[model samples]
Target: MRHIPNALCILRMLLVVPIAWLLTAGEYKATLWVFAFAGFTDGLDGFLAKRCGWMSELGKILDPLADKILLVSVFITLAVIGVVPVWLAATAVLRDVTITIGAITYNALYGYPHGNPTVISKINTLCQIVYLLLAVAAKAGEWAPDTALLILGAMVFVTTVVSGIDYVVTYTRKAIAASRAKHGLA
Candidate 1:
């Protein structure tokens, strides 16, 4: 029972490869369906974890890790196939990379920098997922307009940059405070 959330997370991660393949192969409708299913699993897992008390340390790590894998993979694939702007994909990828490196450095120096996603971070994730969905849907069946995509792309770009900076600033402040506490400097 408690393992269900973690299993869903693994499922989402596994779906990433198929999603990328579908996108690359010009199977946008199929890709949209698979991608939407994958997104649904993300919400389901989170709900089960919170509502059923199925949360665990592994889930804590696995949930967001799965999201990162899916988003980064999709962004890169979209860029490769010319469905999305390359700079947007690059910005999204670089932000993740920067955060990963920051997390590693903070863990090495100040123990695991413990925290939850900020509100901005959550909005950023939502924006990215929505943007990708629209991009795929537009290709799949002309379901979205170009102007809508342009707006979403700009939202994605803003949220990505803002959340990346937010994480770095928030974590850096935490690390600094920890150092001060360790040194008894108030």
Candidate 2:
């Protein structure tokens, strides 16, 4: 019961391989279904964690890691298959990489860079998810228009840049403050 959220996160992570394989095989319809299922598990797990008090330290780590794996895998696959712009995929991957390096450095230098998702970060994630969903749907069923995808991609790009900057700026400030406090300069 309490571990349901963490289990769902693990399941989502495991789904990444199939999603990538489906995309590569040009089974867009199957890929869409599987991706949607993975997304649903993401939401379900978050809900269960918050509503059922099933949250744990492991859940905190696994949830975002699962999302990154799923999104990055799908984005790279879509780019390779010519379903999406390579720049979009590159931007997504780079943002994640930058954040990962920053988090690791901050954690090692100060302590765990503790925080919650900023509003912009949340919006960025939503844009990315919606864009990916539409991209898969367009490939699967021709339900999403290119114009819509273009607009969503732009939104994703903007939000991703903004959120990446926000994370760096916010955490850098925190790290500076922590350093000052440690040195009794505050």
Candidate 3:
């Protein structure tokens, strides 16, 4: 039971290699289905972890790490394949960079982790999936899907930037509180 989350995380990581292979081979259709499966399993992992009381400290770290690495690598690969626009990929990846830095800084200063996913962050993730689907579909040379990809990319870009700011502010406050406590002033 306690291993469910780790299993899912490992599954997500394993899926990434094939995703990269599919993209490199220009198999967007296959990539679409596999990517969707990975997304579905990602959600299932967290739900089962909570429902089955399978959440461990390692799971706390591993689940999100798997998601980040898999999704980030996919976005980068798609950009390299010229299926997704470089700017859109940059926006999505930049938020990841900001969140990672903030997490590390918060841990250093506060001696604890400070966040789960914010609503905005979840919205960003959903938008990213939409963007990926659209981008992959666009590789089939359909204009309508390309339009949707453009819209989804814009939403992802906005949500990602918004969530990045939210995370930095949220975690910085916690770090500041910890600093004050260390000085006996909190």
Rank the models by lDDT, top first.
1, 2, 3
Q: Write the per-residue lDDT of candidate 2 for residues 1-186, one digit (tens) a residue.
A: 999999999999999999999999989899888989999998899999999999898887888889888888888989999998999899999988888888889889888877777999878877898899899899888689889999999999999899999988998899899899989988
The residue pairs in collision within model 3 are none
- TM-scores for every candidate against the unseen true structure: 0.97, 0.96, 0.92
Q: After superposition, how far is residue 142 of candidate 1 from its true place, in Å?
A: 3.7
- Residue pairs whose backbone atoms clash in candidate 1: none
Order the candidates by TM-score, highest first — what do you get? 1, 2, 3
Candidate 3: count of backbone clashes, pairs at least 3 residues apart or interchain: 0
Identify the superior model by TM-score, candidate 1 or candidate 3.
1
Error of 2 at 163 (Å): 0.7
Report lDDT per candidate.
0.93, 0.90, 0.82
Candidate 1 yields a Cα-based lDDT of: 0.93
Poorest 10 consecutive residues by lDDT, candidate 3: 140-149
lDDT of 3 by residue, 77-111 (tens): 99898877788788778888888887887777666
Residue 107 lDDT, candidate 2, scale 0-100: 82
What's the true lDDT of residue 130 in model 1?
Answer: 94
